[model samples]
Target: MTGATTSVELRAHNRVRLLRAVHDCGAGRTRSQLTRDLGLARGTASVLVAGLAEDELLHEEPAAGRARGRPTQIPGPHPRGPVALAVDVREDAWELAECELGGRTTVLEVGPHDGTPEGALAPLGEAVAAHRRRLGHRVAGVGVALAGPVRPGGLVDIGHLGWRSVDVPLLLGLGPGTPIAVGNDTAFAALAEARRGRLRGVRVGLHLHVDFDVGGVLVVDGRPLQGAGGMGAEFGHMPLGGGDRPCACGAVGCWGMDVGANALLRHVGLAYGGGRGRAQAEHVLATSEEAVAAGARALGRGVAALVNAHDPEVVTLSGLGAELRERAGEALVAACEPGLMSIRRDRPPLIESSALGWRGALLGAMESVFDAFLTIEGLELWRRNRGDGGPDTPERQNVTNSTFAEDNSI
Candidate 1:
C-alpha cells in the first residue's frame, strides 16, 4: 500500500480501536487506562480521544485529585451521543428501548401483543415513533428481535404464532432512509449472555435460551458465532429420541418437544401458559413426581448431548430453561451423567441460568444495534447526519471496518 493510504488506514484503525476500547469498558475507563489497554502512546491516545470527542462519540471527565502527579480523565460515551432503537417481539408482548454507547437502556414501552406476527408491526412502529419523538436526532438506527427462525432479507418464520416468511420491514414501513437490523430473539439471548450475563469472560461457551422452544447461539471470543446465513444454533430442533407428539414447528421427537415449559407442562398432562399448568410444573419440582422428573431429566440429557458435540466451556440457560434448572437442577445433572460418552461423565461442562432473565433477548437486541452503529464509520455517518439535522442516512455509510454486520436475519 502507498504511504498516504497506509497512514489514513492506520488513523481509521486507531479511531476504531479507541471507540471499541471505550465501548468494551461499558460505563467508564480512564484515559490512562485506555492508552495502556489499547497499546497507544499517551500523545497518540490524547489525539484519538480528542478526535472522537469532536465527533461527539466520546466524552471525557476529569478524574479526582492525584497527590503525586497530573489528573487523568475518565472516558465514556458522550452524554448526548447516538442511541439505537431496540425492539423485542415475543409471543406474549413487544418491548422497545433506546440503548446508548455504555449499555444504558431507556425502555420506551412494553405492551401486550395479540399473539399474531402481523399484530406486532403496527405497535412496534408506534413505539419506535414515540422514542424518535422523544430522543429526536439522538436515535441513529433500529434493531429488532423476533421470535423463531429468521432468514436473510427480513423473512421471519414464527410457526407457533402463525407467521411464515413475513416481510417485517415492509409491514412496519421503516422506509429506505432509516437502516433497520433484525435478528432472531433466541440468538440475541445468547449474545446478551455473552456480553452482560452469566457467560461473562467465557471465551468459548454455549448459551441456550429455553422459552417456548429452546434456541441459542455459540459465543467465541466475545462474539456470537453466527452461521453462514446467520441461522445457525437451532439446538431445540435437534432430534433427541422418544415421544411421537408433533411439535408446533411440525417436527416429531425434537428436543424442544421434550423440554422447556410446554414440554414439562405436557408431561404432567396439561398445556403451556398461565394457570394450572404453571402451578403444577412449579409444584411438582419440589416433589418426587415421575412426570416432572422425567421432563427435567430430558433437559439434562439434551444438554449433555450438546456439550459433547460442541465442547463449550460453560453453558447458560434463559427463560423457562433457567426456571427448570432452578426447579429440578439436580435431576438434570444426574441425568446428564449417563448420557455423556464416558469421557465427560466424571467432569461435565459447567451450566448456569441466565442472569439477564427473559430480558436477555432484549439486551441482545440492543447489542445487535451497538454492533451495527457503534463503529468508526457509523459514528462518522451519525456526525454527518447531525450536521445535516436528520436521522442516520444510508448514503454516509462507508463501513471499511465495523463491529456489526448487516444483521438481515429477520
Candidate 2:
C-alpha cells in the first residue's frame, strides 16, 4: 500500500482504539488521559480526536481542572455519527435499539411479532430500513439476537420460532460486507453484561437470560466461550428435568422446559402465545415472584451442575425472568449448594441480576463493531506517538505488521 493508504489505515485504527478505550472505561475520559493510557503522544491524540470530532464520532467538553495536570478536554459520545443497531427477537416480541460506542442505548422501537421465521424477519427488515432512512449512512451495522442457536454464517434453527435451517442474512436482505452478526440472544446479553455491566472485573462468570426459553453464556477470564462454530453455552438444553416433558427442540426432559420463562408461565397456569392480551401477561408478571422462586430452585440445580464442571465465580440473570434473582435469591443459592460436589459446595457461585437490564445483547453487538475497527497496527502508531522513548518493541512491531498485512489481505 502507498504511504497515503498506510496513513489512512493508521488513522482509522487509532480512532477505533480511542472509541474502544472510551467504551471500555464506561464514563468518558479526557483526551490527555486516553493519550497517556493508550501510549500516544499529545499531538497525535489531538489529531485523532479532531478527526473523530469532525466525523461526529466523538464530542469534547472542557474539563473543570479536578486534577493536577494542564486543563484537558473530556471525550463524550458524538451527537451524530455511525451508530450500531441492535434487534432482540424473542419468541413473544421484538425490541430494536440504537447504541453508540460507549454503551449508551436509545430504544427506537419495540412491538409484538409472530415467532415464526418469516414473521420475525419482515418487521426486523422494515425496522432496519426505517432506521437507516432516518439516520442515513450514519448507521454502522446491525446485530440480531435470536431465541435459539444461531449456526455458523448466521443460520438459525429455533424450535420455538418454528424456524428450520433459516438463513438470517438472506432473510434480512443484508448484502455483502454490511456486517450482520447473529448469536443466541441470551449468550450475547451475557457477553454484554460481562464486558460492560454487572460481570465487569469477574474472572469467571455465567449469565442466564430467562425468558420464554432458558438460554445462557459462559464467560471465562472476560471472554465468552465460543464453541465449535460459535454455538457454545446452550445451558437451557441440559437434560435435568423430570420424566418426559417434550421440548420444542424435540428433546425429552430438557431443563429449559422446566425452568425457562415459558415453563414458569405454564407452572402458573398462563397460556403461551404472542396474542394481544396484556391482562394475562400482566397478571403473570404480578404473580411472577412466586413462580420465579420455583423456577429459581430448578435453575439452581442446573447451575450447580455447571459449577461442578466449570467453577464460574459468579452468575447473573437477565431477561423477563431475571426478576427471579431478586425474589428467590437466597432460595436459589441454597438450592445450588446441595447440587455442588462436596469440595465445590463451599464456594458456590454468586447469583445476581444483570446490571445491563434488557439491553445487554445490543451492547455486545456494539462491542463487536468496535472490535472490528481497532487494529493492532494503529495501536503501535499510537504508542510511537506517546514518546515512549524507544523504537517499537520487536513483539509489538511484529504483531502490528501481521495485523495490517492480514487486513490488507482480506
Candidate 3:
C-alpha cells in the first residue's frame, strides 16, 4: 500500500487500541495514563484522541490541578456520538437506558408493563424512538435484555411474558439494516460484571441475577458461554425441589420457583396478602430475612452443583436477592459445602454479592453494542479510510506444530 494509506491504517489501529484500553479500564483513564498504557507516543495519542473526539466518541475535560505539573485533559463520556440503547424487560416492568461509548448510562425511561409480548414491545419502541429523537442520527444500536431465552435472531421465549418464540426485533419496528442484539438478562448482567465490575480476571465464574425470575450466566475466560442455539445458563430452571410444585417452564420444582424475587414476593404475599410491593418485598425484616435465607439455600445448592460440573473460581449474585448476601453470606457458603466431593472440599469457590448492583444488566446491554462496533469489520472500515489494501488472508490448512520444532538435543 501507499505511504499515506499505511499512516491511516496505523492511526486507525492506534485509535482502536486506545478505545479498548479505555473500555478495559472500566472506570476512566487519563489521556497521559492511556498513552503510557497503550505504549503510543504522545503525538500519536493526541492525534488518536482528536480523531475520536471528531467522531464524537470521546469528550475531554481539564484535570483537577494538583501538585506541580502541566494541566492535562481527562477523557469522559461524550455528549454526542453513536449512543447505545439498553432495554431491560422484566416480568412486571421495563427499563431503558442510554449509554455512551465509555459505558456511561442515563436512564431515559422505565415503567410497569403487563409482561405480555406486545406490552413489552410497545414501551420499548417508544423508549427507542424517544432516544433516537434526542440523539438524532447518532444512535448506533439497540440491545435488549430479556427475562428469558433469546434466539439468535432476537426471538424471545418468555413464559412469564406469555411469549413463545416471539420476534422482538420485528415487533419493535426497527429497520432491517439497524443492528439489534438480544440476550438473556442474567447473562448480559454477568457479562457486564465480568467486563466492568468485580468479576474481572476471573477465568471461570457464574453470575446470578434474581429478579422477577431467576436468571444467570456462566463466564469462562471473560466470554459468556452461549450454548448451542444461543440459549445457555438456564440455571433457574434446573430441577431442585421434589416432584411437587410445577414451574413456569412446565417442570416440577425448578430452582427458580423457590429462589427468585417473584418467589420471595409470593412467600411474603402468602403471609401478608396484596400488601407487598417492590419496597415492602425488599424490606430487610425478620420474615424477609427468613425468605431470603431460604432463597439463599436454594441458590447455594444450585451454585454448588454448578461448581462441581464447571469448576468456576467464583460466583457473584445480584438483583433483589443480593441483599441477602449481607444477611446470609455465611449460610450460603455453608450450604455449598455439602455438595462438594472430598477431594474438592479443600477449595470451594467464593460466593459474593455483585459490585455493580442492579445496573449490571443495563451495562451489559451497552457492552453488546460496543462489541459490534469494535470488531474486525470496523477495523476493515478504518482500513478503507486509510486506503490500505485490507487485511492479510491466509489459506486454511492444518499444519503440525512439530514441523517448526528443532531436532532433539541432549
**TM-score against native, each model:** 0.87, 0.83, 0.85
Candidates ranked, most accurate by TM-score first? 1, 3, 2
lDDT comparing candidate 2 with the true structure: 0.70
Question: Candidates' lDDT values, in order?
Answer: 0.74, 0.70, 0.70
> Is candidate 1 or 2 superior in TM-score?
1
Q: Which stretches of candidate 2 lie over 4 Å from their true place?
A: 1-13, 64-71, 273-282, 288-290, 375-410
What TM-score, to 2 decimals, does candidate 2 have?
0.83
* Candidate 3, lDDT over the whole model: 0.70
Q: Write the per-residue lDDT of candidate 2 for residues 368-397, one digit (tens) a residue.
A: 654544445433343332322221244433
- Predicted model with the maximum TM-score: 1
- Each candidate's clash count: 1, 3, 0
For model 1, give the RMSD to the true fold. Answer: 3.9
Model 1 per-residue lDDT at 280: 57
Q: What would the TM-score be for candidate 3 when compared with the true structure? A: 0.85
